[model samples]
Target: MKRVLTTLSAALLVIACENSKGPELTGDKPPETAGDTSEGDSETGPDPDDPPVVTSAGPTTEGETDTGTTGDTTCSFVCDTTGGTGPDIQCDNWGQDCPDGQKCAAYANDGGFSWNALKCVPADAAGGEVGDPCTVEGNGVSGIDSCAFGSMCWAVDPESGQGVCVALCTGSPEAAQCAPAGTTCVVANEGVLNLCLPQCDPLLQNCESGDLCLPNPLDQSAFVCILDASGESGTTFDPCEYGNACDAGFVCQDPIFASECDPGAKGCCLPYCDLSDPECPGANQDCLAWFEAGMAPPGYENVGYCGIPQG
Candidate 1:
């Protein structure tokens, strides 16, 4: 399938600008510089205590080392595939500095620009394998722990501080490389990274006993296997701990629309519907706009959930 670059939301745009100095894994922001002090300089020469002006060599040129310095402070740009930067060292431009069998890949921080800084990573390494506990630490500034060559680590439940590493695959089911036999590659994020998940026909409601096949919020064409929420006894609405914690046929919606929910409190599990044939099983329930318009492939305006109609 064609790879579609993920769109940057307003929050992500702000992060991109804030992290323009380096890769998103390091989460490093540009340091604040002191105000100019030209008033104290003599007409004949320079000040004895003032810091020296430092200039960048501009964007790095091919095969040339780039350096930045201020006063006695000096930093050199270096490329190391292993990870991390040291005193006077910065990451190298992946395109220009990476060795053979390696490619420069950008993580997280995304905006109009290509990438702020490049990391030399194995051309085929995703960082971790499937079922591994995936996480990124150190504010994402220096380096990051990523999945293996053909996988991505996604948060399974924010509240539980749990995540799973899943293999990345094309939209074609035949190309899926999921383990344990029958799982298929589902379009977790259409045009972006597809994930290998257990297969089930939602219409038939025949899942692996305790699981339910539900349409994904990002892609209706694909379904995900989640714990059945139908057995939970509650009113029409109830708070949830995880995105899939609600009773069967309901999805836990976060109060804040984020790529990952905050720990402890996800939102309420609500019934979702197909806009093409909207339906609600309870009184005063109506299909309301869930995801915003144009957030995904079919457009956010076309996606909705069954809920109480607001006045």
Candidate 2:
């Protein structure tokens, strides 16, 4: 259950990588190659126009794609800019350090929309508890959310200031946790947001209405439902710069995994599948493990990506 913070909520994960803003994290590239490709038919063989690509576990080099676009902003930046929300008034998010009836919260300080600092803000004395419908004041980063202490307003409607109250992680960063069982605490937005997002199954795609199941921004070890920032494109083999830039069931993968993908592109979209039902597009592609051996969490052992098998 991760909630990425951006100037625009719907455009949250669309991380525009300007040096002044977003931090780089392996260039948001998803899982890599599954196997070696042998020359064969259209699906299994390299495309006539596209050449083979060298695969490796590293951040992609900054450049343009087949669509002739770069600086693609479609992932949350794990920023470290920690300026206080207000002058000489900082508060601890783990502890209710603010005066009674107030709570510690995060807000943007760099004239940007994402939260990078913490401060004391008024807590709704009569506000609903976790999972209750809530409202935010000013904007999402105003920190004037009408959520109870230890919770924050999430999924907010920009125009209406309406949203739901989600639980914040309880312990310190080293031992951060969610009180709710089965919930995963995702730390994002410069560590200002320690959200307790719900764990979900990647294969089922069983998230709420608009959100889609994807690996958490912090790590791919667990599955969490994040907003669908796939936008209008993110189709198969579409160039992507981040893990969340692809449409549902697709993730940004290395070009070597897909025969039709442009090797020059930073990354391309590939499908996620089950080991029992391998629906990999290419003839040489197979549903391979998304994580290293014994690295996957329980229940996620079968999670696989469509890619060429590794020898």
Candidate 3:
């Protein structure tokens, strides 16, 4: 809605300028010279010969977004009947414990972008099923999207509210799962974005759209594609917490797994290497199996990490 209004405002300005011009000097008077700055109207104010002012009360459509500045509160609600403040309508994201036509979804209520609240919303919006293009009702945090039953819109553009439907992780959070074999469930944003993300090869790092391939958080056996949140400083031995926090060819490892890592650090970035030709950066270190015996997915059996191998 903001986008539309801004566009409309621009168009209106163009039309007004075109209308305000001195009627092209059609009848008798010759057209003014190019540098003629005759004091008809100053650049700072409206034109004297401009047409009647045009105004729009609001959007013609019933549902339009109110997304403002980025720092403005993203914490919006779908059921804020109690004057935009009330107890959250929590529900099971896995079970989707809502009425027959509704689905449970996570959202935010605090000032930040994290999904710290839940709500049940009607599922009769727009796009349904996974991978479909969709839109959000209010802002992105409204928890009311155009996806049906078991999916929620992901990768939403905050201003436009446009996104794609992604399947919510099924089963319990502890034992979360996805449908397709190659896709892994990704639980993120304080568990609001529980969707199936595609798996990738740590060696090849063949993720779509520059996403990083890292070890699956559910299990370290295989790699999964995730959005890279590790900005410029993602180099070797960089202290990190999340697996994707490391740049490409590196994965987050505990101090025990990362040789010479800061003794008190929680985790650090380490390189992945081919098991067939083992290599390590530190002295006496060896590329060890990242996953347990016989656990790596097919074609990725040779994936290993540089670490101090135990005898």
Candidate 4:
């Protein structure tokens, strides 16, 4: 019985030893060596040595790098109220959102994405007519507005002689729908190039003999003489109710009848000598008789036979 029990104990001890070796064989791992470390890798996740990404706010083509963001844009609207040309889209340096005919341009508002309505600049020696539109670089004006940021030009009328600079709005060139001739909307200070002249009173007979009585260019309601500074009249005087240029010795005593003699003409000194006549109330009888008789003379129509002095 003793021997058999010893044999069972020995078998049990061998089984226990086998069970202990199983865990050592299955759970064991090789030791990490110094060569196992890599310079291009990180223990956390992705490698830090990778290149960075680039992006921009400006426009780009398809397949370009984009960070997935957007920007704003600006524009303008212009149209001719007159039945001339149709609406046109042009580029200019005016603020965005102007009335019709205005252009789009950069302004203080918005982040530089707007339109500016371009205006005509004044005409210089090289510029167009006073009423015609022009740009700063001497280009003809066409209404345009845009949203570009930079130095821009405007069309304007330059002043001449004595005329003032008058700004113009949209209108027809053939008619005064927008502005009068010789006048146009332009940059400031352009009116100095306009001609200066005296405005004649329309109520009076402003037309001098030989002077063309024309409508005032500045104010249509007024009258003005086309004659130059020298009072001499021109060959063709605008049709006056009654007037004509006179000889060198004659004066415009009655502008209504510019050439005909007044009652107190030197050829008829009696009128000048008449007591009731305010010109020469106290003329002598000899002077009066001589004046009347001179008028009757055949060749004395332009003769001087009065008390007045003649050079």
Candidate 5:
């Protein structure tokens, strides 16, 4: 099913990162050999102490796949500008062997069952810049063609497999990364990931004439500019596709209450408020904290919604 964000009236949240559940990288092991024997020793057997070996038919090229051979074993390596034969060690082992300004990271395969060979990746802003289209190709691994070190690829349209590289920033709004004049840093995934998004103010309608300043799907306190919903102004309990679809003073929230939306349902619109407010939409609704205490920036304790407290 297609993935979408939904919201609950009382409390709703969403994460910018897609929940694709890719495999996580763990410890490292010696590169596998093409031929294996139970005896563990053969003419093609690799010595455990030897550094990983790489064999390429010709000169290594950046973003190109090459075969790395150690003894009889063969593994694939994505060449970078480092010009190194192969990673001298796995990221889990000793430090990265990539050239200056680059780091090593183990990338998991698209199947989410295993990982490809370790490769050197830029440790700084040497690759794709923010807002560049990126694809999950080579070896079918996520983050393979990852953006520059401080950026991540966000799937803008899951069905079309279209994504854009966004720059990561710190959690604090004031300390967030510097961005273009019209944009600001927004907390995309709480403490996990932050991104530079267009600056907007929902209350002032500071966005473009037709755009809306809506709470980020990942964090209610953070706002971003998005296109105006085509139909009538959204109200509480109205279904919404993006947070910006809601009318002024209302936000699109996941229906699951304190959780993200289900894959299909985008969510319903809800009003946000400060706990200091005296009244709510209904008697059953009460002001409840939306994010954990430490999860949000300072002065956010009063940020909440008039809704049933989530368990």
Candidate 6:
């Protein structure tokens, strides 16, 4: 029951950084590793830890330590001199927030997010250091690094003076080193349902490797994530259509898939009247009208759609 905001729906998650216009940066180098940083020459570009001034929007969080690496194994940064979108951390608006599996951070053309930002380590990466802070690059009063993928951040809101990193963008959560071998930690629905559904809710679903909790598209009322259904019941829900046969006294109606009781056999109606009784045999016979008047099953609820046409 979860739907992810499309990569295009920047407003759905963290602040939309896509539209921000700024100078672009492009360099030749493999993107940074997840959560952890690899050694590099200072000329290779300062480690992501250095607080490079983002030409467009600033960092996702204020006091964001210019330290460590960011992004996932495959996620990389390319300087867009054309200035099409702001940054990969792009979002539609400030209210959309970041997607479940992903986080929001101040990314720049300088490639700091990947090279200097925190590496995408597992939740338990760094030897079970769940909250230990690792310096990506910038100096800070506390030597104890404290940030992770998807964790909240506080960047200065250009619109509002208050800082807000509501969310951060890092490599895939599952890619983090915290999880054990052969066991991937992802958002709720990270597998087969990735295309059909987006996002998962941690409260309702347990994200596996590479997965994060998100909301549902059908109804935002609840949150869910995609997961392996191999162990789950294979049952699926289908709706009823028009012109199907019924036992007696019912009709098909709107939200047709859910199946509801309809007595009127008008307006693209389906069979629902009871024919077992001899009195309701003619074509004009109204099944539900008669049944409701104390003529059929005491308490009947047709769980299934209209039955096959016997005639």
Candidate 6 wrong stretches, greater than 4 Å: 1-107, 111-128, 133-136, 139-213, 216-311
What is the lDDT, from 0 to 100, of the residue 89 in candidate 2? 34
Candidate 6 lands at a TM-score of: 0.19
Compared with the true structure, the alpha-carbon lDDT of candidate 5 equals: 0.38
Reference-based lDDT, residue 6, model 6:
12
Listing every candidate in turn, what is its Cα RMSD in Å to the true structure after a full C-alpha superposition?
A: 19.4, 11.1, 23.4, 49.6, 18.0, 21.4
| Candidate 3: residue 75 Cα off by (Å) | 23
Model 2, residue 210: distance off in Å is 1.9
**lDDT digits (tens) for residues 1-311 of candidate 5:** 11122231111112111222111100001111111122433331113211121111111222121211222323221122123323332332122345777645434322321223345565545666777875443422333555666555543232344456656553333344435555654331111223455655544556543444554433345555543331364676666543334666666555543233232444555677675663556445666544544554455555565454433
lDDT of 2 by residue, 22-69 (tens): 211112222112221123312322111111110111113332111111
**TM accuracy, model 1:** 0.33
lDDT values, one for every candidate? 0.33, 0.53, 0.48, 0.19, 0.38, 0.22
- Per-residue lDDT of candidate 6, residues 1-311 (tens digit): 11111110000111112221111111100111111121331221112211111122234553222212211212223222122233332431212244553322333334332211111122212221222323322311111123444332122223432221112212332222213222222111001000112233322234432222222222222222221111111111112121111111222122221223232321112333333432322243333221112322332221112222121
lDDT of 2 at 20: 14
Winner by lDDT: 2
Q: Rank candidates, lDDT, best first.
A: 2, 3, 5, 1, 6, 4
TM-score of each: 0.33, 0.69, 0.63, 0.17, 0.36, 0.19
lDDT of candidate 4 over 1-311, digit per residue (tens): 00000000000000000111100000000000101133442222111111111111112222111111111111001112222121222222222234443333211111111111223322233323432332322111222212111112221112211111223333221132223443221111111001222233212324333232222222223322322111123122121110111112211121112223233321111121222232432233112221132232332222221233211
How many collisions per candidate? 22, 14, 0, 40, 16, 95
> Can you tell me which runs of candidate 5 are displaced by over 4 Å?
1-126, 137-141, 170-174, 188-190, 201-212, 215-222, 225-235, 238-249, 252-268, 271-311
Predicted candidate 1 versus true structure: per-residue lDDT over 171-288, tens digit per residue: 2322334453545443211012234556544334455434544443223334455433222431235654223334445544432322233324424445556666788665566665
lDDT, residue 141, model 3: 57
- Please give the distance, in angstroms, between residue 256's alpha carbon in candidate 5 and its true position after superposition: 17
- Candidate 5 lowest-lDDT run of ten: 22-31
- In the range 1-311, model 3's lDDT, one tens digit per residue, is 00000000000100000111100000000001101133441222111111111111112322111111111223221112212232354776766767888888766555323343567888874457787878776555557888977887655643455766777788864677898667876543323345576778878889765566664434445456654434464467776534444677876555555556775654566788899998777656677765445665678778877766443
